[model samples]
Target: MNVLVTGATGTVGAHVVDGLRYAPDAAVTAASRDPVTARERLDCATVGFDFTDPTTYRDAFAEIDALLLVRPPALSRVRRDIIPALSAAVGAGVEFVVFLSVIGADRNPLVPHARIESWIADSGLETTFLRASFFMQNLSTTHREEIRDGRLAVPAGDGKTSFVDARDVADVAVRALREGITGAYDLTGPDALSYAEVCAVLSATLEREVEYTDPSLPRFLVSRYRLEGDLAKAGVMAAIYTTARLGLAARVTDDVRSLLGRPPTDFRAFVRDNRTVWT
Candidate 1:
């Protein structure tokens, strides 16, 4: 059962290494600080882990039994040194970890996602916390230049968001790393719209006219782009329009159809299945 999928070519760690590629006896291992862009987007066998080199995580934790941990959205290079290189890979034996937390992670402390969910709930290994949401592939990776300039612009006014499906949060983080489950799963989306109903379902799945512009959370964090640095970005534009002005990420949850049996894909089927990455 050797997992190890930390941001291995991201967007839910490339669908948790393509849903653990049918796990014949599970052995995935695609950690990455670019083993040539995780071996050109991960077929597998790509290493070089780099949480700013905690001596490259003992050759990416060698026989790494379980890990799927992806908390690297930069936040000043993981608030200065990747949570002690993920608590020194649970003191070098890295048993089970799965964390990809978000969605008001235990009430966002200026969003380092509640300091990486309190360092994976005080890391003593065996954790789960997937908690994902707000990622309908950020309309083709980080709001693709405001959906290629048609403007689904910022400061999220109506704020509601249940948009989940990054390969259904990588098939529920590869089914909590092949069934070692544990806790915290808020992985949303079966519908909870309102970024003006997700720009009226991306203007009817890219028929055009995609405009949801609400400008002032520090002027949409100075015109957002990878939410520009210096760590506050107006406290992530006042916690994403105060989670859509206190609708609190709307609601809608069957916990991804009770953990991926089905039914989590809407955002108008993720804009008619990625509408050519927003026209």
Candidate 2:
């Protein structure tokens, strides 16, 4: 089996590359925007590919049996970039596609994630949608500076979220890539924990008191740390925080267990494993 993984340098895509390396029968190809940095680190054959360019898709799709499509974060415009890849995959006779999508995307039109989900469903290709919740890696990277400063600042108000480990998401993606599963699986951690709970876990791991501070939405919206890139970007992040505040993302599921035959890793364990990031 030949598998092509897009966004190969990303957090989840990096793990996916590692997971695919163990499958001896599979020819793994890692596609990245910057091959010099991303390709050298990966064990598989690397190719130069960018989402915005249609010409890159045809060369990458050539003789590829299945694909793992991951959307770039903070990227508000995707249809123009992704549709060409989907069409190229069809023309290349690609068998399967595994998409890393956001949770509750179908119910939230405010988010562009739903639009991508719709595009995948209507593409006339066999696909497996891995709808992942917010990633715990966000704490280690995006919120790293805040954690180092001993405070977790956010606009999410008392909102509980089921954050999953990126490794687990990669495992599921590799399984779908190799086995060809055809359904949407909502991947999440074993428990739903509030932002405060996450801070507490970090405190325990770092052995320093960490606090969760609820900053005003208006203040953050206009702050320098604003993640808003465009209309879709701003609206999507707002919907995510809104969903968290409304307790929409608090549900825990056994989809990870069903797929991997083991329970999903909890948040505390993730913190303990990556304590150096917090310190």
Q: Which candidate should be chosen as best, given TM-score against the real structure?
A: 2
Among all windows of 10 consecutive residues in model 1, the one with the lowest summed lDDT is 225-234
lDDT for each of the candidates?
Answer: 0.75, 0.82
Per-residue lDDT for 1-279 in model 2, tens only? 989898787888888888888788688889987777776788678887887777687778889998898877656566775677677788998978899987777677666677888887888889898888889998998779878999987777998999999889999998888787889999999999999988888888899999998777666555523543454445556667777787778878899989998889888888888899867
RMSD vs true structure, all candidates: 16.0, 2.0
Model 1 clash number = 1
How does candidate 2 fare on TM-score?
A: 0.93
lDDT (Cα, tens digit) per residue for candidate 1, span 145-164: 67767877766677677878
Q: How accurate is candidate 2 locally (lDDT)?
A: 0.82
* Model 2 CA deviation exceeding 4 Å by range: 224-235
lDDT of 2 at 253: 83
lDDT of 2 at 2: 89
For model 1, what is the error of residue 131's alpha carbon versus the real structure, in angstroms, after optimal superposition? Answer: 11
